[model samples]
Target: MNELFDSVADGLVDKSYAIIDNFLTTDEVAQILTLPHFNQHEQLFKKAGIGKNADLQINEAIRGDYILWLDKNTAPPAAMVYLNRLNELIQHLNRSLFLSMKDYEVHMTVYPVGTYYKRHLDQFKKDDHRKLSVICYLNTNWKEEEGGQLRIYTDHDSFDVLPVAGRLVCFRSDVLEHEVLPATRQRLSLTGWILDQQIM
Candidate 1:
């Protein structure tokens, strides 16, 4: 309905690369989080302070669990906006790739400040459920030199994206192996995937 949201959707449909810049503004993000229809689901913000050891041990090919600190008391409006934009992006990508998004699962996740996930692929072993992955940056006043870039490894090339404000990175969930490096500052972002088919 707004210019920022419209722009992000259009941009994602146009680009199928690892990084997309200026995807969503902070102001636009706040709107989606506060909307009653979007906010009423009531299961989003729950969090647990689990240590990083278990997360790191997660196998790369095996489908991982929803491991994140979902700030139960906080409304990360930016995250919601990005996730909304991402769902649209997946649908567009599906159209291009001749896949239907409704046949799978989609989820929204967040990493705040020091939250870092080890290198992994979103697809599952013997499942092949995940097809596309998306990450949306929400930190404002972020520095490109702060070192919170996503490290994506491909057979032919490598890609890194600064956890800068209003950026969304999308790639094939199975092809791109990526990790969230440690940051010099607080890095906030939305991370998730669109599975190829529903396993549950």
Candidate 2:
């Protein structure tokens, strides 16, 4: 809808960057097909042969709903609008707030019912490429008690970003430790890192 963002979005895509906010509306996200399959990816991790029912959460996730790899090229026009919005946000943070550009990558993550991700770091201490973390929640009709809050940890405090539709959360990917609490309702989000331009 705006000309200013076209260049900005292109810049961020070229350089690993950071910024966050409602990038995808609920209806916009539903365009991506989701199929149901049980522990289909277990064989991918068969080397471990995790015990039966021994909690196959992460191991089985690569199979849709549990975890879906978005075909960004197929995203709707709404996604383009959202990217422009993010470009604006990043400019605000950089010029007004003074956030440094670092190595990062952009991505989308979706979680369905009874799904949860354990606490993890955006980038490994040794591998510092993922410097900025951004998340945009796209699940409509979400409730606090539904329990899919993004637990973010800072030096002295921890905060939860409830998975509200159109809500976005951005933070230091390297310094922030976060997790997704299990949800009673289906929860969805787009999460990714922004890398540094100079690094490329």
Task: Give the number of the best model, judged by lDDT.
Answer: 1
Assess every candidate by TM-score: 0.63, 0.62
Candidate 1 C-alpha RMSD relative to the actual structure: 7.1
> What tens digits encode model 2's per-residue C-alpha lDDT throughout 60-178?
34223333333335544555455555556556546543656533344345555776766767675555656567777767777788898888766677778787766666666667677
The candidate that wins on TM-score is 1
C-alpha lDDT of residue 56 in model 1: 38
Summarize candidate 1's per-residue lDDT along 1-200 as a digit string, tens digits: 23443443454445434465677767764454344423322354434232233443444233222334333235366444555556566566565556676533333444444556677676655556666676666667777777777888867777777877667776776666777776776555556666765544
Root-mean-square deviation per candidate: 7.1, 8.2
Residue 187 miss distance in model 2 (angstroms): 0.9
Candidate 2: the clashing residue pairs are 16-195, 102-196, 103-195, 103-196, 104-194, 104-195, 105-193
